[model samples]
Target: MNEAIKSVKLADMPDYELVKSGTGGCAGCPSPMGLRIVGKALGPNSIMVMTPSCAVASIGVMPKSCYDVPVLNVCFASAGASAAGVSMSLDAQLKSGELTGEKPTVFTWVGDGGTYDIGFQGISAAAERNDDFIHFCYNNEAYSNTGVQRSGATPKYATTTTTPAGKSAQKKNVPLLMLEQRVAYVATASLAYPQDFYRKVMKAKSIKGFKYIELHAPCGPGWKFASSDTVTLGRLAVKSGAWLLWEGEHGKLTLNTPTKPLAEGKMPLTELEDYLKAQGRFSHVMKSPQKDAVIDEMKAEIRREMDFMLGREKL
Candidate 1:
């Protein structure tokens, strides 16, 4: 039943609530926003595969789920492989007329620690083979569920359990990597803009082959920010040009609104300082001798990313 979808406006958001309330999560959690909208967009005919991540903790143990859809918990590095197997099995049964129901959509819900590092091997293999599944990487920028340790997606100068002083390396560009792999769809979404993410998820549900969507999850406890300030922090991250909003299908890229002008250089990136300062993770950098240097480096990286994504610069 998947096909070209009409644009889903904020007001047009469906009432189907696949993810229920009273689920476990830190106060002011951002992943729930994604879970809710993604559920609505995918509707009820979907099976979700999960790895070790915040959702595992929030949604609780098996048979104790608040989710309305079928969920399979897989090993940390096997979400891609596991979901692919399930999809293929469903297809086989459907073709034989042995399974009855709407064609089930298979997808994975994972975190940055899984996607950018350990699970990349399996995820990449699945992508290379064009697996019929969707992988959602909810990046809080660290292994927030496990002592706030650093991960490949951790931004520079952020203090994590493993990188107390600061991190030296830049974040791995997973979406760009997916684009290079020539997947069917690659997109970046943020919690502050549910409408953008909702539409993208709905569109990806209709597309064949691998689909990857990385959500910019705002971490409160992990980032040392209040839960209530999560949404504002996400908006600040975008205004500062730290995070981007975009989608690409079959190599045709379209920069979404809000971020379009920023990438086009029509709007100045003026909120980087506020964005970084709002989270305590970067407090050490802000008070250090290299404060200006650190921020300058971050700005430079953001510009470089935007320019590269816009095809104005070579990688």
Candidate 2:
């Protein structure tokens, strides 16, 4: 975990050491690394409402848990609702003088499949009510636990079990959807940039009401990339503009960083191709001309989205 943190440009602090060997995380899973970082940022005085995703499986059963903080593993569709309940209960306790000291920060941690699909309605209800909790979606881009199936958050032209390379539908814009709710804080982070991610997580901890962070967590087994390439893929995803890192408070929008300029000899599309080509999941796309066109179109869409978000005239 220390090595992974260092690789991702994050500090190797003692606080972020909850996930040790023997945990249920895969041999090299980015989700656990993300959990460790997020937990460290949120500190020990937080209550996590994890859903039926890799997070629950990774943390393992009861007595031998990977997380240092209190974890409430709930049903897949109840993450947001459960976290809201925790927040409400905490508030009630504080009001009744039944609890003293600082109130614990509540968090709902779910995967892309859980958040963008199965748990959408619960999340929407919570967000609409301006629930006081941090809702984090650690998107690996698919239903990884269920064998690399396509989820609403899956990228366009990506090859999942359900959506082959030839699939025509585009990925859902989840952050934008949450932004439309006019929540307090909405941002995007990736495992590759941990300092940035940690900062956002810490910022969310300090804020009140529906704080949502969409964290990009790479999967070695599902994405068919080597574990070592997780950070590389993360960087490439942002550089390609496929994953925009921005924050929206109320109705305002701010691009955290300018997209890597294509005119400045930075060919994110080529880099993205190189990154994807290394993965077996996208191997078939490389061999087919039609799939290559789809990939190009996806890249174009990414560029367009970045341009729109950054308020730029063109890519």
Question: Could you say which candidate leads in TM-score?
Answer: 1
lDDT of 2 at 296: 74
Model 1 per-residue lDDT tens digits across residues 1-315: 233665677778889987787788888888777898998899889999999888888896666787888999888889889999999999899999999877788999999999999899999999999999999999899998988999999998899999988898988989878877879998999888888788889889888899999999989999999989988988888878899888877666767767878888888766688998899999998898988988888888888888877782222
TM-score of each: 0.95, 0.89
lDDT of 2 by residue, 1-315 (tens): 011322234445445564556678776688887878887787778888888788788776668887777889888788888999999999999999999899999998899999999999999899999999999999998899878899898776678888765345677888888877789888889887888788787778777889899999889898888778888888877776667777777646666653445423344344567666767777777888676676777677876776666563221
Residue 78 in candidate 1 has what lDDT? 95
Winning model by lDDT: 1
Please give the lDDT score for candidate 1. 0.87
